[model samples]
Target: MSLVELIAQADERGLAAAGVSCLDRCVPLLGGDDEVLRPLWASLAEDGDGWGERVAKIRGHACDAATGAGAEAVSGPRSGPGAEAEAALLARRMLAAVPAERSAGALREWADTCSVAALDIHRLLDVADDGNTSVTDCREGRTEGMPPLVTAELRRQVTVLELLAGHGAAGVRQALEVSAEGRRVLQAVVSRRARGRT
Candidate 1:
């Protein structure tokens, strides 16, 4: 099913998972450890009821990580200090994209916005781009300028949301696997960007 159709059919839990998974996978953009959002994923997987609390905690952690507060220092090097600020802004957008109520409307909004936001984060860190083509072009019709890794991440985000929307709770595992794949792709992107700085 298409992403719109699947989202229309998803239940509350499925919708929530769709949004959470997207944000969870994008954690690396904030220079956060990969496991930072694991608790939120665990909550969804086990049907635990503390989603709000988890979201709050994650927001705090994102803030700390952005400011280099109590959070762990990201191990690899950075593209530059400005890259962190751009990444942090994108991470904040992901967090804010989520809504308080676990309704289909909220999830749809979050899912759509988060998908674009995640791509924007990748574009911000894509230092290789020489401005001949923009991410906006990729969304339009020009995919040649976009990196394969970023393309894969965008595809995964859409797939996860579509799966949840189509299959609801029954599709959670598959959706998560898709999200995990995206996370791995973004991790590689992050690593490459860091290495290029050296």
Candidate 2:
């Protein structure tokens, strides 16, 4: 099934995992370490017992990281930091916007939002054109001639939802592993961009 269909049919846990997985992969843009969102993943394993608290704690860490990156970088569009800063802000917003309720309706909205935001982050950081002007088309499976980064991101999104749907709670750890791989890719891309600027 398509990602939108998968998300529409997903349970509360699936939706949460889907949203968290997207945010987890984009952590590098927020200056987060590889394991920064691990606690949130763990919460998913236990049926979302402490999701709100974990989200709050991670948001705190993300705020600290974003602040250290510089208020100018995150707050100003014309200050010359450009796409990287914009991507960071987007990633930060993804974490900050995570739903406290974790209800099916709330998580569905958050998952859809995170999916778009994560794709936008990838598009911003990707050096090549992603063909489509909006990432929404790519999410809906209109992909053709997509850039490497965007293509990989779309694939990751599909993989995550499928894992969660097919395995239920058993898929959470595998989802984390998938997200970790994406995080490393983004970290490398961020590092390459930094090097290019110097």
lDDT by residue for model 2 over 65-111, one digit each (tens)?
Answer: 76756234544332235777788778878888998776899999999
Candidate 1: C-alpha lDDT = 0.65
Best by lDDT: 2
lDDT of 2 at 83: 77
Those runs of model 2 whose alpha carbons end farther than 4 Å from true positions after fitting are 70-80, 130-132
**TM-score for predicted model 2 compared with the true structure:** 0.92
lDDT of 1 by residue, 104-130 (tens): 687777866765666667666666645
Q: List the residue pairs that clash in candidate 2.
A: none
Candidate 1: clashing pairs of residues: 6-165
Residue 6, candidate 2: how far off, in angstroms? 1.5
lDDT value, candidate 2, whole model: 0.83
Residue 192, model 1: lDDT of 78
